[model samples]
Target chain A: AAGVIQSPRHLIKEKRETATLKCYPIPRHDTVYWYQQGPGQDPQFLISFYEKMQSDKGSIPDRFSAQQFSDYHSELNMSSLELGDSALYFCASSLFGAGGPYMYQETQYFGPGTRLLVL
Target chain B: EDQVTQSPEALRLQEGESSSLNCSYTVSGLRGLFWYRQDPGKGPEFLFTLYSAGEEKEKERLKATLTKKESFLHITAPKPEDSATYLCAVADTGRRALTFGSGTRLQVQP
Candidate 1:
């Protein structure tokens, strides 16, 4: 079975250009999450989607937005990318709403990541 | 505000050396805590999750322990391949988003 998959493993874009990253969740998972990792830093929560709706968002600027379609795939869009937006973007998926204490289905499985460079 | 802090920003250890990394956190309610290992140019891979105080989990040469205020990842006689950044996170407050620490970078030299 294919785990989470992200496209364009590496991307280089000019400032003010829009960048779109895609993610396909596990075969049957229903929740997708996006995270950003800066150099020498830990991954930061960007946003999460469940049942085709956004469940939560972190402290990101308005330039970043995400959408989930059909419960199996998601897309992260950065409009007018800034230099600060250069980072590794990771996509994760897990079973839907399995968020309690004892269930492992809710455990996140991460994709390799998409390295974005803004120049 | 929920926060997670990892100590020693970086560590350099030789093969066969045993050491530990620390993750201290402060949150409103204790939902769960997690540990992940990330190689260069890769995303984090989940290692373990601790739900409450006094919880412990082990995998291979790595052991994770949790307390009310902090968690620790202990490496036993590590190998060079164990070199990677270890991150700790808490999923409780701030809209159920995970608050991560600036990870501990470990370099194991052979």
Candidate 2:
């Protein structure tokens, strides 16, 4: 089974710079969620998209924005990077309405996270 | 606000030892409860999802049971490979994002 794919598995940037992280979700999965895991902390929800539309938002910083493309892939764009922005970024995908007792609830499969370091 | 709390910040076990990890959660309306295993520096691997109280699921040496307010992950005859952080997360009704617990770090020794 093909899993979610993330690009630029490792990244480094200086303060005030810009970075973009890309994620390719699993085939046929219509929902994509992004999360940030800081050192010694649990994963925090950032944002999510469904069918090219912004479905939900969490604690994502104002300096950061994300979008899902027509291909069902998504990207997280960060600007004026700060050292505190360094962390592991993960992308998870799930299929909604896949017939089941709980059609709205689906299992999310995660991709190998991208490690971002801002200096 | 949805909240998840996992107990025993860390655990150490010898090979073949059996134990259980606990996760207590509070949500306005329950959508799903999820268990994931995460290796250091890697993304969380999906384990199980329990939707309602009295629900149970199992895989290999692991079993998960859920109630109205909490869940348990029981590991039986564990091996060193099972060493990792176990995370519990919940989705509330109409919410697309998950609220995660701090996780329980398990160290299995040979």
- Among the numbered candidates, top DockQ falls to 2
How high a TM-score does candidate 1 get?
0.93
- For model 1, residues A1-119, the per-residue Cα lDDT tens digits are 67789998999999999999999988888888899988776888899988898998886679988899975699998999999999999998887556564432246888999999999
Lowest summed-lDDT stretch of 10 residues in model 2 chain B?
A: B90-99
lDDT of 2 at A34: 99
lDDT for each candidate structure: 0.87, 0.95
Model 2 error, position B1 (Å):
0.7
- Which pairs of residues collide in model 2? none
* Per-structure clash totals for the candidates: 0, 0
Q: Which portions of model 1 show Cα errors greater than 4 Å?
A: A97-105
Root-mean-square deviation of Cα positions for candidate 2 versus the true structure, in angstroms: 1.0
